[model samples]
Target: MNPDIISVVIDKLRKLSPEKASDLTVKNAQFITLQSLDLDSLDTLQLAMDIEDALGMNIEIVNFPATLTIGQLSEHLAEMRAELREPA
Candidate 1:
């Protein structure tokens, strides 16, 4: 389940990458080092949107933790995805 969500987030990030921003679009095999992609702050917000769209979760930046890393983002999204799956 976590893997699925992670893949979705990664795919969304890839799609958001500028077509000319090859530097920002790492090969799928290198998603783990996404921070190395050199995405700007705006791109990060775009990433959040992608995550929300993919997970169908409401992700407010103010509610987001300060932890800023690809692995951490994946974990956070996985947690959100799990919560979304729960009966509410």
Candidate 2:
């Protein structure tokens, strides 16, 4: 699950902002933020849509704070997934 979250996030980040191969790695993503990625509001919306499509979870932009990091986003998504798996 951890790997999946990180991989999806990394893939989306790369696709959204096509940097060099050396850029946007899991190690760097720990501190990378949406703002730093030059992801505007539209880019963010696209990211959310892509994530929902890929993971089947409704992770909305409004659900996050202004300053959001990729690592934090991955962690939040993991929590959401865990909640879905819990017996309600």
Candidate 3:
């Protein structure tokens, strides 16, 4: 993903969940860890909503298991945005 997009995502997520700000960072597509953050269930849900609204893209969490790390989440979001720009 682009650094600009990554930076924006991190900024928005950090603003919404400052406690998790320390956990925000980019990693290889499959290696971003989310376990370091103390986010509870509700926080996770709200984070998802905030990310979707910030990026103007719908994130599909149903298919992804609940154990995603911040890196994985970031990668997934970047992929979604890229997919949005591509033609069907």
Candidate 1 total steric clashes: 0
Compute each candidate's TM-score over C-alphas.
0.61, 0.88, 0.65
Global Cα lDDT for candidate 3: 0.62
In candidate 3, what are the lDDT values of residues 2-68, reduced to their tens digit?
A: 6765666566657756875665666532454444455566656776676678778776555234577
How would you encode candidate 1's per-residue C-alpha lDDT over 3-62 as one tens digit per residue?
676577567756765553453322432344445665666776777787787777888764
Alpha-carbon lDDT, every model: 0.61, 0.80, 0.62
Backbone clashes for every candidate come to 0, 0, 5
| Per-residue lDDT of 42 in model 1 | 75
Regarding TM-score, does 2 or 3 come out ahead?
2
Model 3's C-alpha root-mean-square deviation from the true structure amounts to 3.3
All candidates in order of TM-score, best leading = 2, 3, 1
Off by over 4 Å in 3: 16-32, 63-66
In model 1, the clashing pairs are: none
Top model number, lDDT: 2
Per-residue CA lDDT of candidate 2, range 1-88, in tens? 3889878988887888997335778887677777777777888898888988899888878855547777888888889989998999
